[model samples]
Target: MLDDTLKTQLKSYLERVTQPFEIVASLNDSESAREMQTLLQDIAAMSDMITLKTDGQDARKPSFSLQRTGTEMSLRFAAIPLGHEFTSLVLALLWVGGHPPKVEPEVIEQIQSLDGDYNFEVYMSLSCHNCPDVVQALSLMAVNNPRVRTVIIDGALYQDEVNAREIMAVPTVYLNGAEFGAGRMNVEEIVAKLDTGAAARDAVKLSAKAPYEVLIVGGGPAGAAAAVYAARKGIRTGVAAERFGGQVNDTLAIENYISVLETDGPKFAAALEAHVKAYDVDIMNLQRADQLVPATHEGGLIEVKLANGGVLKSKTVILSTGARWRNVNVPGEQEYKNKGVAYCPHCDGPLFKGKRVAVIGGGNSGVEAAIDLAGIVAHVTLLEFGDALRADAVLVNKLRSLPNVEIHTSAQTTELTGADGKLNGLNYVDRVSNEAHRIELEGVFVQIGLVPNTEWLKGVVELSKHGEIIVDARGQTSVPGVFAAGDVTTVPFKQIVIAAGDGAKAALGAFDHLMRMPA
Candidate 1:
């Protein structure tokens, strides 16, 4: 199961282990068990500090635990952590073996200071790009705090448990057998959820901070670029984001990003964060801005209010709060969300393996989702409200070649139908014929475009008909000293490169505005 290239990488990473650790595997007599044994043996052979033990009595086969020598610090994996989660597995090993993590000292302290025991069980899929963040977070907490325990379960491998818990989403987390959260979450976000007083404390600290010369909201490609450009100008730059990466976190593949041949969303997001961190930009993650207030006077500071009762004042503000996946908003869509209706095919496609599903929309994302689902699902029914597919010719041709896929143009999704707390089918209408129809399916993937994250800015700035912030060529909004960029703005293309360029333009525009202000 271990390839030569992977073995070399694993060996190099294991060299950072300062403490001896043992891999205790609980595997039964099965094909997967043999594969697991081989993988563990390959790992143990790389370092003398590592030992393999098969004495684990865990009921979950093909499961393993990494335990530090002469200590109780440990974490478990009930599935083979490969694909996107392979990095998570390596990080857990390094962390458990005494290699220091790359996190802020304060964050480490917070995790170690947690009061209660947290036994976290996270169900994930190998194809899910979002699962690694959550798995790595809980694993880091477990490695840091002996009171905390984490078990990363592969939903595909543990189908019985997944069905029993009615889990229909990837990276579905459970704490003490109760559902905690489902989706991409970092360590800081997890800590904030557990520590009841952390928000209030954070709010007080944030409110006391000095005003910034350039403050960027949201942490997608646009926000990151703006932060870099502003910090380069020797100005006080700050970024307050609900979560860094925004919609980019949900993206699976990116072959169009300039300068780079190919890369995934998480990798790109990480690089963006690292680049911004290299500058003087002060990044505040897990911070949500609910309101934006313009400056009253010519030189007054603009006030941005946070959801945690914290208000940040800035000399100039850059709004880059990127867009989110547009929902169908049809009946039963919300009620069956995660139960049958999912927006992210990359993360949730495996849940419907061998089951019939429908892909709503006929754009690039929708067509790509249908193609991706065709490989895993039994049958894919694609519905497009338009007369023809809006995807590129290449993608449309590829999708048409799939034998298990069917396309229906001029089809508008009317409602999602389900039974027993699960999605069972969906209703649609033939726009050209003015006739309604229904199709039976276990899952529905909504691939509609994006809705700008400018709802909070409503009544605050001039917006386009689609709710996008109207900006000039220099990226200045109607409100002076307030600039917008990326998907939230009136930019034509929502590509990453376009967003980055617009972000830089907005930063320069803000700087120009600052230069003209009275001292």
Candidate 2:
């Protein structure tokens, strides 16, 4: 099933496999089963240490398991692991065949030491960029600990299973028949969830760390850039992030990140992390800062308190906590999230295929979502609070040209209506006519905009009316030795390139401030 170039690459990757492994597929007479068999054959043909067997009796047809020879270590895929999941399949093969993963030693040890039986089933879409992370993470755990078993299922291929579980989101994970999580999660995050004592241990370790010269309170593009710049200055630097990549992880196509022609969010975010890691920056992932405590005396350390009871102190702090999706805050919006209301069109769009859906907002994101969904869904109803669309002319034109898209300007979403834990429709009002309206749909995609992640700093820092941190030209905030940048700051445009530049400027500003301080 793979092209010649892909075959060559797969062969090269499989050469790293040191131990014997086998692909045991459970097949049927369906075309997908044949395709899966071809894929397995191509993969098995790459390495002499790898073997293929089609005699397995799995309940799910077109499914396969990568099993290490003479061991219970195995990972299963219930669908063709192509598209975004192809890399996940390759990683599973290598890891299952005794090829070491590029994870930290401590993380590997933690995975190995996990005591409980973890039967993880992940429902993911092939188009979802975030799915691979979850699949790979669980695959890593499964490869390390025999007690942990991960089964990756393609949601599009297994629509019956998805519907039965009422799964409306990609990368929805179920642990032992219960909903575990329903979004992008990394290995550390998953481990923390499984290991109850991990938070206290992490908090203790974080609190004991020495104060840094520059401490970045985010891990998006801004925080990464700041870390690189600070580390280049040969000063102590640390980064604390709720989740590395921030809002960018939910982003799909990023065509305007200069020099690079085109790339997705996950790849770009991974690159950012790798670049920051190349330096001596101490990165604390899955760490959410809840409060900022400024120094009482000049040249004193600024303290950033984490939600996990961890406190990190620094001489100069850069606030780049980034932003999150702005919810409509209407009734049932939160309650129906993942039930039918989704924020990411790219991730959840497939789940609504052949079903009527609504897009909230008339900006570029909303219009783009409508345009994209028109092809996959039965119909897209776009509601805008303004009289006119705020999207680019090209996007507006494209959206208008689509037959399946319906646009409603001056429409305010008042409530999302649903029953039995599933959304059925949404209620809106027309400002022009003052008439209330309701549209029946299976899914609602909120694409209004982002809200800065500055709620924690509401009373701590000087904020704009919109809750963004007020910063000067040098990315310096109102407080002395405290700088802010990225989406969390009062930056005009919240672009990746802009955020990175702001971060660098903030890092330089912090360095200059530190130079003038008394030792």
Candidate 3:
């Protein structure tokens, strides 16, 4: 399915291969096997060093294993690698054949210490950008350990299995038959679970007793920044975040975050966590706060109740719970989700390197995505349901300057079409002409809006009609001793730089609030 341009790119990647590599493809005379066989053959043709091995090990379940020129690495994918995951397939081939992944030695020790065989079932979609990191991490660990077995299942291809498990999101990890983890998690997180004997997620907790002087909620840039600032003050500070890095974890290409010229979501998230760990802040990771226990007395303490039967007490609290991506809930969108429908352009753009793609909601984010994808993909079609784009003049101008970009305002997307568990095209309606249109594209990126993660604080604190916490210039909310920052507040803009500044302001406000209390 690779075009001439994509072939050229793959050829360049294969040029770096020095050792011989072999692909042991186990498939039956099925349609998926036929498609996978052709795809793997094409990949082998790109490099004289790569060879394909076909045999019927288990025709019921498709499996592909990659080994060194003459040696076996024991790394394999039990399914076809298509859509956005094509990049991951290529990377894994290169890593196993040429350069081995450079994982931390401490991590290697943890993996070596792990006993007993654990089978991991990771649910993913083709267009899911974040799934590859976790998948690759598990593959690397499996290559290092004999007992760490993994099965990568495409959610769209196996909808029945997904429905049976009640799986609603991508990157959902299942250890054995029960759900283990959801959303984005790295290697250290999985290793942490192994260390604690925690079979599933949600059993992990922080200190339930002892009230901290300052408590920060949320784990995005704003919350992380606040915790760093507060912890630097040499006071008892703790941050209770559902997931550290907030919306920043799902975002891509943060070029406007001050000195950094360019960076992706996962890289920036790791840096944020590393920066926070350098201090003495008690980071309560993986704990979702359900309700806030308000203090009645002047010197009484407040409690932060969590969903996992854990509670935290504090004298002051800062809310930095960030936002989530706005999804386009259309037909076949949920079905083909990672197959060809995607949310983050930066993470999955490379998968559609030489393929045609579309961007929905031609606002600032849509325009930005078009600009980003245009540089990588063959063409970009941007759709907007409004009369005109609501973006900065510079962004629109840059988008227009792109040669492979087409913008269509007043265009309402009707449905996403797919076949063979992958997306192939999309349908839209022209508002002005009142006519329907269809376009053949490999991927679709939804970049419309941001939904704040503030539903858990509804009745506890004063919130705006849109559910964002109303805060003043000092980042103080309606409730005393409580502050909010970042996208979760009624801030003017949701930029990373703005959120980081607001976090610092909220930290200062919380510190000031605590100093006035009895010591």
The parts of candidate 1 lying over 4 Å away from their true place are none
lDDT of 3 by residue, 1-519 (tens): 777887898889888877787888888767877878888888899888888988737433467877775553566676687765777777777766675566678677788788877778887777676787778777766666767776677766666676566554577787767778866777767887777753233343454357898898888899989989999899898987767787777865678889999997767887998899899988877667888877887667887888766778888889888888877778889887767787877656655667899999878888988999999899999999999988899999999999999999999899999877778899999999999999999889999898888888888888888888999998999878889999988998889899989999999998888888877
Q: Candidates sorted by TM-score, descending order?
A: 2, 1, 3
Query: How much lDDT does candidate 3 score?
Result: 0.80
Q: Which residue window of length 10 is worst by lDDT in model 1?
A: 66-75
lDDT of each: 0.93, 0.93, 0.80
lDDT of 1 by residue, 1-519 (tens): 778999999999999999999999999998878888888889899988899999899988989999998878759999888888889988988998889999999999999999998999999999999999999999999999999999999999998998898888888999998999998899999999999999999999999999999999999999999999999999999999988887888888889998899999999999999999999988999999999999999999999999999999999999999899899888998899889889889999998889999999999999999999999999999999999999999999999999999999999889999999999999999999999999998999999899998889899999999999999999999998999999998889899999999999999999999999999
Q: Report how far residue 232 has shifted in candidate 1, in Å.
A: 0.9
TM-score of each: 0.99, 0.99, 0.69
The TM-score measured for candidate 2 stands at 0.99
Ten contiguous residues minimizing lDDT sum, candidate 3: 199-208
Superposing every Cα of model 2 onto the true structure, what RMSD results? Answer: 0.8
- Over 4 Å off in model 2, which ranges? none
Residue 308's lDDT within candidate 3 is: 64
